[model samples]
Target: MTNLSAFLAQNAIKPDSQERVVSKRFVDPETKEPMKWQIVAVDSDRDEALRKQNTKRLPVPGKKNVFQPTTDYDAYLATLAVECTVFPNLHDVDLQNSYKVMGAEALLKKMLLPGEYAEYLKVVQNANGFDVGMDEAVEEAKN
Candidate 1:
């Protein structure tokens, strides 16, 4: 038995934001140190919206006017990374222009190399609490 008041909006605990050195190439001019990127946990509502935006409707075979919704996982991750990134301002037009990219997702893709991008995606997932699995959690609990 738990008090329902604890579930109230005001009583909710907000997710913590984290900063990680995503790239060593982007260094501070004065300190000559790697720059850190700020990432935050995306709420479920926003996550759902991003997912929907990346999903496409494909025509189903043998059925006229029938469509099946398919989610583009790579596109969704790129969008999620863009949304969760608080620093470097991926949405900035100037940044996009400098990278010769149009959208935030494109800007992110252009900013990092392939390997860096993949690692950054892992960091983003960790920040969003997606790095944990139920099996691991169960194992840890039993220990």
Candidate 2:
């Protein structure tokens, strides 16, 4: 029989938080240097919740009392980015007021430019382990 002890929660490796220089726009006032954003890998439960929140059910036009589920990908990513970010406090009221935005998602959208926003979303996805592919993992394992 295989040793299952290593798979136990206590024995398993925990996800570590990471700091990344996502953008050069935000800088320290005194240091005149870019600030790194803190991010962490969120558990699957949180991701599932976000997914469900973004998904909407629409009534099927031809069917009786039936609905088709659809997910808003852009909304999901925006929410995910806000959830994973740990530094500069996206939820801070002062930050939101400064950006003239009401919510965390809105603040993030307003802070970064169009291209920067797209790149930041990619960075957020990567932090959550979405950047790796099966082929890349296989290659790394082989090496």
Candidate 3:
């Protein structure tokens, strides 16, 4: 096979995105009830606006006051961009006013709860065709 053909064959896109259901029932922090969520890996849109969003970044407020991603959660709620908003802090907020002009793709990096963050990372890595096995590797190293 020619080198050109080999290169073309190497980058085939998967027909379906990766998705995983929560294995164990989780307690909804607020409702105190069992909850199950299906986490799905999605594609990032390469639109001009989105590109601009990524290019633009929020400044770190430093030691005194750190920024909160949940503050911008409302915006993602409208676009349902939770999958894309992986880097922000996801603190529980009853305020409907949160999630606004958070500076470009603020949703790109929300601070999620530890478990939620791990799940989000899994989706992102899978979308990028990365095996999310660093944790497993670390565990194996300990043995």
State each model's CA lDDT, in order: 0.86, 0.85, 0.41
Deviation (Å) of 120 in candidate 2: 1.3
TM match of model 2 to true structure:
0.87
Q: Which ten residues in a row have the lowest lDDT in candidate 3?
A: 69-78
RMSD to true structure for each model, in Å: 6.0, 6.1, 11.6
Per-residue lDDT for 37-105 in model 3, tens only? 343344445322333333323445674455432222223322333443332323324221254425333
Error of 3 at 7 (Å): 5.6
At residue 25, give the lDDT of candidate 3: 46
Q: In terms of TM-score, which candidate is strongest?
A: 2
Expressed as tens digits, the lDDT of each residue in 1-143 for candidate 1 is 87999999999998888999999999999999999999998989998898889878899899999988877777878888999999989999999999898999999999999999988988887788786553563344233
**Residue 64, model 3, lDDT:** 48
Candidates sorted on TM-score, descending:
2, 1, 3
The segments of candidate 1 whose C-alpha lies over 4 angstroms from its true place after superposition are 132-143
Per-candidate clashes, comma-separated:
0, 0, 13
